[model samples]
Target: MSEPFYITTAISYPNGKPHIGHAYESIATDAIARFQRMAGRDVFFQTGTDEHGLKMAQTARDRGITPVALAEEMSGHFQTMANELNISCDRFIRTSEPAHHAASQALWKAMEANGDLYLDRYEGWYSVRDEAFYDEKELVEGENGEKLSPQGTPVTWTAEESWFFKLSEYQDRLLALYNEQPDFIRPESRRNEVMRFVEGGLADLSISRTSFDWGVKVPDSDGHVMYVWVDALTNYLTGLGYPEDTEAFRKYWPADFHIIGKDIVRFHAVYWPAFLMSAGISLPKHVFGHGFLLNRGEKMSKSLGNVADPLELAERFGVDQLRYFLLSEVTFGNDGSYSAEAIVARCNADLANSFGNLAQRTLSFIAKNLEGRLPSRAAVQPVDTELLETVRNATAIELPRLMNDLAISQAIESWIKAVFACNQYIDAQAPWTLRKTDPERMEAVLGTLFIAIRDLAIAIQPVVPTAAGKLLDILGMGADQRDLAALTAKGWYEELGNSGFTLAAPTPIFPRLEVPAED
Candidate 1:
């Protein structure tokens, strides 16, 4: 049997609409999921919205809507964003859904049974803005000398009666688990931070709030509601058919990866696993906390008026262009900036000029010169062997490595390098010139180019889906005929070993951008 792979992105907070940061996380996870599917894993990918929170209540009040109505509307926005971004989530699970609520309640029952949950008055510094409690020592003075919470979220001290989780009781066990499974948290840096925080000693966590009625209610509690993170985190299992149905749970539980942003690493790496263990549930295989996307050296924030509307950016630049920009701009686990200049430059350099240009030039030549049919080859030259090896080597080595590590940029760089080599071979062979002087030699050259272009489209389909699909269409390759798994599973030194190109009226996959002159 093939290995099973389950992946999820942290559900977005439904307090507001989607932004570039949300798109960045979803797209990154989607790309990895798609790659794993192509590599022949039985893959399950989940993404959704966190609809139950104090922030949801405030947003509802401001909009003059009930919290449930507001959550429904905000959840719709998240769905639209995922669709526009081409995020291929297998299941979009909302925390407010019946299945999710049931799963969460079941887990709560389990924890209760295990003597891990109890009712107590929580009187500490709580930040509704952050949906988190802050210790006095964690506060620091902002540039304006106002005290800022650990995440720089401004906070006010409040006392409330709430239920608490016995996080302090499991510190040593959590540390021991971390020691036994070092790969549980990712990027090494994030893991070190989580361990240090856990080792410093943990306090019992406030697990329910009485300040808002917009969240899940604690069983038999009059005013208190379950904490949003605790409720929200359970959706991973809910989406896998937990509690009521165990088939999907049996098949895909213990998620292979939980892909999330650096901002929420602690919650995912620490709180989540502890919650599962206390409830007698198995932990996820890995938690990879990636870096943030910054704008002008500041974290993108709505209050700062610096939110990058992904839809607006998609309107200005195409969706495929936006997808390419996000993956290519940064190493998978590092923070990076977003600039229009950078996006346009990468579009022109990598997509339009490099990969797209190779297809257009090759196909256009065949359409005009060889009556739009793939050239039949009867011989192999040293150059053909070299170029084919480049294509095969790229798919075999770099593609799997990137997908395994969730390093989208590195995988794309490896594929683009092959396309660059193919373009260079086209120039060196001078297929256009040979068409007139040595027609047979030109046929062989075009045949080789067709083979490279076919492999390029199949190899790159995971990263830029639409663009790669269009490339396949231009080559007259049937949409469903490409075998991506076979491509990646082969040996590096071996060629794709077949050509199935029939040229059609070709159009540019990604058109070049022309800068407007200063007025």
Candidate 2:
């Protein structure tokens, strides 16, 4: 059996419609999952709505609906966004599912049995927006005289009888874990920040709330519900069929990756591991906290009224086009700015002018000049040998290494260089002109270009699945030829054209966008 690689995105909070930020996480994680599957791993990718929280209850109450009803409505938007993006997630685990409730309670009982859970009064300033508590020292006074959490979420003073986790006792242990696993939190900056926060000492975290009844009820407790983070994080386990599914739990447990936003890194890196430690369960291998996406260089906010809907963006630009830009433009683990102009410019330059143009020009020549039949090549020339070697290095080595590092931008850049090399080869060799004077040489050049396009299409499938799949279809590639793992089989390169493909008239897959003039 192949190695199992389990990955998950932080479940979306189903308090509102899906936005660009939510889509960004899904796309990035989906790319990882897709790549792993193609790389011959048994991959399980899970993402879904986090439906249990005070914010969900309040929002539902204001709208005169039950919290579950609100979750159903808003979660549909996220589900739609996932479908529109062609996300290849294995499961979308909702926190409200009975399986999730059972798994979460099992976790609570495990921690309680470990003697790390206790009943106590939680008295402090709580941020409803963040669903977190803040110490007096962690609070910043607002200019308008309101008390705010360090993250600037307004906090309300509250004292409630709650169940507490012995988070403080694990402070040194968490620091030790960070020391042992240097890549546990990712993007050195985020990891360093987590280390610093943990080094500052920790406080016991409130795990259950009596103030809200909209969440998973605490086992053997009176009118208390498990905190949102506990219920939300448990979805990862629920997606794996935990507790009763020990066989599967053993197979897919110790998740390989947990992809989450930077805003929630502390929760995953600190509290999550601590909970797992107390429960005698293995911690996830790594948690990557990616930076936020900004709209036009400014944060997306309600007051600005500029939160872009991801579906609208996908609708305006092609779905694959947007996926390409998001992965290629944003340096993984660093903040990236998005704008209409930037999106258009990137699509035109990278997709339309460079990649799409290359494929169109090559395939069109073969379609028109060669009569829809792939040509057989003569003995490889020195130039053709060099070009093929370069492409082989890119498709088999450099791109894979960059992807393994999660250096998404770097990987895309490396692939672009190899792809653009095909364009340069066609230009220098002048295959169109060769068709008249040197028909034999023209066949060799076109043959080499064909190989380049095939491999490039295969390499880019993880990032732009729809577009790359279209490219393969135009070249008459079969399902067997497109499996990424098949690239490494013996005779894979030599036999690339052994079965031979009949060509179709190639059309441009990515078109240049015409932006509306600003008023």
Candidate 3:
């Protein structure tokens, strides 16, 4: 049996509606989880909304609604979007849930027991927008010549009685832990940045907010609420039934990956791990911080009026199209730009023209010439053997890199390259011309092409799931395999190496997108 694998996307803050950024993270994480499942792993994937925060509180007040009401409505929308995108999350944890509250409080109690929790009077610059306290050196000058938070939001001086986590005490220990296990933070660059930050200096972090009552209440403290990050990060454990439930926690704790955006790299890589260490819990294996989607040169943001409404994009084109565009256009862990024109171009070139057109033509030829049945493989040609060998070899090379390094976009590209090679093989062999001259050779060629297409569909499913599934259905391989694991050089292919496939009438997998001519 394959080993157990656990992954999670950052729990989104329910301060606003879902945008392309949220969709991007979800789709990327979903692909990884789906791929792991295909690899025969017991995968636990979790995602949900961060409903306890000052932003959610203010949004509630602005709309004359209770926080619970607003969070419920927005959380439902997030769920709807995830379902629409076919997100295979095992748990959708909400921090406001009783289970999550208990788990978070339990973590606080654990830290207290560990002597990491202490009472402190906080007097510093706080950014309400970020719900974070910033040091003077970390602040930058605004256009108005005032100090601003790292997020560019203005910071104000605040004084409050709060509980603090003695983050400074663990700087050397955290560094030692990271050095001991270098793979604890992923992608090298993120790891280096985190190490630099830790080495520069560490400060105690305020863990409670006395100014707001919009979060997990500090246990035994009536007037203060737990910090939003502290509350939000606990969802990972809460989803696993932590604290009260020992068996479940043991089963899924110490997640394999935490997929977060670049903006929160520091939070996930440094603060989160430190918190875990303080509580004597094992840290996660990897904190993979992927970059954001850019609209032109600027970050996509709601206030900037540049955020893409996920549902709108899905409605205008299609969910699979959007999914394909996001995953294929951008290299994972790198920032990428998105434009409608680029989306249309990729759809037309890669999808409609390349893979889709090849499928249509191959099936059409078989249907018209061979009575809609898979041609019998009576004899093998050099080209047929070469094609199958290329597939087996490429699968061997790419699958490990994709699985171990999480190189998702490269994995899809590798399979697409194989598909293009199959197309070229067919065009050069001229199976249609050979059909009359040498029917047996033609059958061999078609047989080889059919199996190649089958493998292609299976290999590409994790990236473009819906389209690949449709193509596999048309090819009559849908029932035989659900993933690339089915395409191995096993007894089935070798035993029937001379057999032919009964082809089906193919439909366009991805129809070409056309733009209107300007008036």
- lDDT values for all models: 0.84, 0.88, 0.83
Of 1 and 3, the candidate ranking higher by TM-score: 3
Per-residue CA lDDT of candidate 2, range 405-444, in tens?
8998898899889877877888999988888989999988
TM values, all candidates: 0.95, 0.97, 0.95
| Number of backbone collisions per candidate | 0, 0, 8
TM-score, candidate 2, is 0.97
The candidate with the higher lDDT, 1 or 2, is: 2
For residues 189-277, write the lDDT of model 3, one tens digit per residue: 88898899899999999889877788888998889899999988988888888876576678778899999988788888888888899
- The model with the greatest lDDT is 2
Pairs in clash, predicted candidate 2: none
Off by over 4 Å in 1: 488-501, 514-519
> What ordering of candidates by TM-score runs from best to worst?
2, 3, 1
Model 1 C-alpha lDDT per residue in residues 241-317, reported as the tens digit of each score: 88865778898989999999887888888899889999988999899998889875688877898888898788777
